[model samples]
Target: MLTAAIVAILVTMVLALIRAFLGPTEYDRMLAANAFGTKTVLLIALAGHALSWHSFLDVALLYAMVNFIGTIAVMRFFEYGNTRDNEGSGSTP
Candidate 1:
């Protein structure tokens, strides 16, 4: 069962990669990339179980957090042209 799940996830990840590369718009690619990351997390968990890896949970959780942060950073760049917020940009004292 776990093997089947891992295979399915890998298949979707490949599809996501294709979308990321062939997507017409950056937004579409970003979404695909995000999906790829999510699928990776699932794959990690499933594979860990199948392989009996004790540390898979920790690794998957960390990777998931990284994926979330990376997606947020990419969206911020698209929205603000940078990661840093320009608070109180009226004038610098």
Candidate 2:
């Protein structure tokens, strides 16, 4: 069961990679990247269980935190970027 899950995750990760590369918009690519990271975490957790390793869960947790922060940061950047472009760079006197 664990092996099957790991394989499924690997397939999803590949699909995410393809989307990240071929996505038509920046947001689409970002979403794909986030999905890949989530799948990676699941893969690590499952692999660790299958292999009887103790520290992989911790690594997965760390990766998950990083992925969450990175996604938020990227979303903020995109959101503010559009507003900045529309609002202009000139300071009000």
On a 0 to 1 TM-score scale, where does candidate 1 land against the true structure?
0.85
lDDT of 1: 0.90
- Top candidate on lDDT is 2
Q: For candidate 2, write residues 1-93 as lDDT tens digits.
A: 777898899999999999999999999999999999999999989998899998998999999999999999999998777565556768663
TM-score of each: 0.85, 0.84
User: What total of clashing residue pairs does each candidate reach?
Assistant: 0, 0
Model 1 Cα displacement at 9 (Å)? 0.6
Off by over 4 Å in 1: 82-93
Query: After superposition on all CA atoms, what RMSD does each candidate show versus the true structure?
Result: 4.5, 3.0
Q: After aligning candidate 2 to the native by TM-score, how far in Å is the CA of 42 from where it should be?
A: 0.1
Where does the lowest 10-residue lDDT sum fall in candidate 2? 84-93
TM-score of 2: 0.84
lDDT of each: 0.90, 0.93
